[model samples]
Target: MNLEDLRAVRSRERSSDSLQDLRASFYEEVADYIQERKDARERAAAEADDPFSSEEVQTLTDEIETAEQVAEAIYERRMGKLVKQASLAAAGMTGDTDGLTNEERRLYEDLVARIEENKSHVLDVLAGEVEPGAEATGDDDAEPDPIDAAHANPEPGELSEPADDAVAPPDSARDESSAAAAMGGGLDGAEEPAAVDDAAVSTSRASDEEGDEAGAERTTVRITRDVGDVLGVDERQYSLEAEDVVVLPEENAKPLVEKDAAEEL
Candidate 1:
């Protein structure tokens, strides 16, 4: 990769780093909470003759008070959230029945699956267990991964910062220009161009013109497989892991068939 490529990669890595950093804070809080919960459970088990307390009793209440104080001292701004998270974990582990609605349960399950997939991907990346990209094959119809769509084809100005010297003109100047332009007046008394010269600039654009990358464009060949091809099941029963798939976009491609009924209307 050249300098531009390197810069692009660094930008991606920096974005990835920021995401990881945000998660790291939560991980730290989780770790500390888990440790404190374990220590309290251990201490409690050793203390009372009847270690199993009543259903009304709160486990590790004393330890939590101390943990809250310590957490506040360490992370003053985040103490509330951290303490609440730790409390929830402790409560969940101790069989304290916190209610989860049906929707919440479904969402939680989805989050768990994503977490698992991310874990596997991270390990695979670290261990060099997978190909850098997908393995090339003669087979057509292999769709690109949806997860890469956001990061794959970055647009111009997607990550650019404005120049330091940029400034806005006064509102009064902006209003005056707007008012003058609306009152059948031209800026700086500009005149209409001569008729002969105007014809040169009035060119018609072809309806089917290709975008900027006409010659060097990547082809996104559609991949179609019978249900039995990969799944070994009927086409109707072919459950898919959409997350594992890579999908490349077809340039200048329009959908042939409308998937949504509303679109037909």
Candidate 2:
């Protein structure tokens, strides 16, 4: 619980990949020890005629800071081991839990439970036992509409069939009807070419407008460092490297530019 004790624990944690056994009240003791040093430092400052000249207060202050750093280092190292242990346990490869304090044990259990739950759901989806984002219809036996059924499962050759109620025209009448139809078709076809041209122009203009809108939302930047793969705010994946020039959504580009990892172009 003293400064030397804190340093020794930190050294042991750094030397060993596995967590070292410690008392269940180890962190509580460390906190109490730091608080005691702070109180002592304050008392020494008040008692000394010249607080700035007091060596005892200075020593206590230094010890408090060092103890805090050492405690934090030990905690980070143990936490890393606990996270790895939790992952292994979730995968059915349980590790030693004897070294965990009550709080850490609870955290470990929670992590394992979450990992297992996620894995189970993902595996069920992969196995096709569950559908992704699918909702239950609650009526499995409900019949499909006739119109929808016909469209989904059309009969072969049905589209090519003619209506049954039809009459044949006389030969002379048919010849006159064909002549009149040909003359009307010639007149309509002349306007059809112009209509087709207008449609092409309209489609091209729409595509250009879409391109301009997309350009406005994104920014051009040059990568100064290798950012292997990043997920953008726009939900697009970008693979970038040093010296690569690319366009990214403004939100995603801003962070990189501020970090000096990229320059806005």
Candidate 3:
């Protein structure tokens, strides 16, 4: 199709209901027109007694190629405009919404959904960073520690189930205030030793988990046919096809795997 013809088709199909149909029809026309040219060439060659004539067809493949090129160029221009409009909507640009038609809104929502779907990778999934899901899991699964977990329900200065080897102190010698202050607290108060131990252990485990998440090496994966486009990983890009491998964090690859788009290496 010529430039004017393509524009005519697009203008007529700009409505939401006809947009998909328009794309399908454009591709079909390009394919059919190219095939028609080839068929005409073969027929013309056969008509001549000497099929291999020195005369070349002035429009040999040019019209078909041009048609294809024009179609793609139109698609790219439209796609660029739509992407910009969608971005402006996402950024909450006022007055930019003036001309957003129903068709454009649909396209805008789709683009927004795609960005949200990949948000984990865009923000948190990266080299030396923990999985985005991990952070979510950490938040969801974490339980608040009880204030009296260490020593529950104890009387003031009363030793917790006196140790086996402990000797009984003279009643007068065991002043409750001095003893409670010494142990940092009695049954009624938090045990300093127990609280300290718990805090230290919790801190240590948190540090270890942070280290594991940060030091985790990149994993490799292969894209299956389900992933019909090329994707960018941390430092490279991988085409979407079977047997194509890419290295990335598990969080970044989760959607692909869930979609049957890739398998872990």
Candidate 4:
């Protein structure tokens, strides 16, 4: 072979070898990097407050590896196509032929752009980032709640039971009050006997129910009303997500929404 032909052959051979090495080395490097990440994740889990056991780690790692492999496959295919095109162009452009036809120039530019784009995607995937425009979707076929689906109830469900008041006296106070009212009105108070009797019955019933639930068994937490008043309106307006707060107080210091009549105009 002539000097130019020998040079061309050597160049093609080197390109082929380089491409082969890249193909193998890419996966090996990616595998090692992924393994290192897995090891780090396992160590983190072990040190976490709620540690993942070996079995849990194994399961999660399996899932993660499987997903990563799928992503790598897509990256590999895209990269392989681009590399093949680039290698073919390199092989064709053997001599120092800088001056080219319009079609050839366009093809070379397109090939270069494709190579760059695909190579970047492969590197991104290997580095544990997702490819552009790839989205994962799942089934959205679950049935809705009957009450919610119906929309019959405009309001949310019944309010949870209120927390007990700490400063307020127990059921005994109501009992004393009832006794005093009964004694004060017993045939010697204002209005007719029937009206007096009805009022006493109503009061007694209310006192009995209140006594049943409002005994010393109730536990209460207290906060100052003025402290609640000092809270910014913006803070009051924002609702907390379940994950945002460590613990929700049994009783809210302020009502969820202030009533127009409840607040002074």
What TM-score do all the candidates reach, one by one?
A: 0.18, 0.50, 0.31, 0.19
Residues 1-265, candidate 4: write the lDDT tens digits.
1223322322343244232213323344445656675776778678666655556666657645543533333233233334455656544543222433243345556766565566666666677786556532222376666876555444576543344634676765665454333222111001111212444445544544553464411111111111111112212221211111111111221231121101110
TM-score order, best first, reads 2, 3, 4, 1
What tens digits encode model 1's per-residue C-alpha lDDT throughout 140-213?
Answer: 48676665554475577675344565788897567544432322211011113222322222220121123123
Clashing pairs in 3: 154-187
Clashing pairs in 1: 141-222, 141-223, 142-223, 143-246, 144-246, 144-247, 144-248, 145-245, 145-246, 145-247
Q: After superposition, how far is residue 136 of candidate 3 from its true place, in Å?
A: 11
- Evaluated at residue 107, the lDDT of candidate 4 is 54
For model 4, the stretches where C-alpha displacement exceeds 4 angstroms are 1-33, 44-56, 91-265
Best-fitting candidate, scored by TM-score: 2
Which 10 consecutive positions of candidate 4 have the poorest summed lDDT? 256-265
Instruction: For each candidate in the order shown, give its overall lDDT on alpha carbons.
Output: 0.33, 0.67, 0.47, 0.37
What is candidate 3's TM-score against the reference? 0.31
Best model number under lDDT: 2
Per-residue lDDT value at 254 in model 4: 26
Kindly indicate the candidate among 3 and 4 with the higher lDDT.
Answer: 3
